[model samples]
Target: MRIPANRMPTAAAYRPDSRDAGIRRYFGLVQFALIVGVPASRLCSWRHGTHIWVPSPDIQVGDHPGWSMACIDAWVPGGDPFLRPPVVQFADTAAIRARYHGMPASTLWACIGDGTIPRPVVWVDNRPGWLL
Candidate 1:
């Protein structure tokens, strides 16, 4: 399921639109936190150094892993991903992963880790670590 940012706070907040009770059984707070936390933290790397890591503001929601790209290039003026940290809105990534814990990691990784897709570049500003 593709949960757009406008519909949810983060990818973690999404739940599958399935009737299967098993699909709904595994969701929990901890899993949701990890799903949101991993990418959010990765995107925040600009505060420490030059692009330690950064995921796009958009994230794929569901049991399946999906890749993301930034809305704007980091080098463009006022386009830095670090400068614009994704908001911790309602039902974000933390919630989505929790809802779809049963999905296979292989599938998830395949969608998100595909080497063929082009990703936005994330530039780091190390002058002030943790400032952002």
Candidate 2:
């Protein structure tokens, strides 16, 4: 049976299709920082620098800026993977080495030489790095 209009819940009582309560969901600075794999402190510094690390925010709520998904996708380059930073930044070389089964530089270089593995396709600070 259908309920009468007067007996039905109001629009305000229902969850919005696009928004969380009254506020629209957006990727804020914290979210942007995580996406680019950088410390929020570092992002903050970039935000004020001449070459801002992030594109202009899609929206600004009060004092904070927020980015939309489209904005981020367009800002982050899609071409030349070697030129971009790793999605998860490593603090030291040890962490990166762990990814390749703890293989040392010499062994990795040998593998590339013997055709056991592929050569590095990505460059970190002009030094070619391997990914498998």
Which candidate number has the best lDDT? 2
- lDDT tens readout by residue for model 1, 1-132: 998867655543443335633321222222333344444343444423564433333322222222222222222322434554452222323332344564453554354468532222221111100101
Q: What tens digits encode model 2's per-residue C-alpha lDDT throughout 29-48?
A: 76666665567787777767
In model 2, the runs with Cα more than 4 Å from the true position are: 1-23, 77-132
Count of clashing pairs, candidate 1: 14
Candidate 1's C-alpha runs over 4 A off are: 1-33, 36-43, 46-49, 59-132
Instruction: Give the local distance difference test score of model 2.
Output: 0.51
In candidate 1, how many Å is residue 21 off?
A: 16
The local lDDT score (0 to 100) that residue 95 gets in candidate 2 is: 38
| TM-score of each prediction | 0.17, 0.37
Clashing residue pairs in all predictions, respectively, total: 14, 0
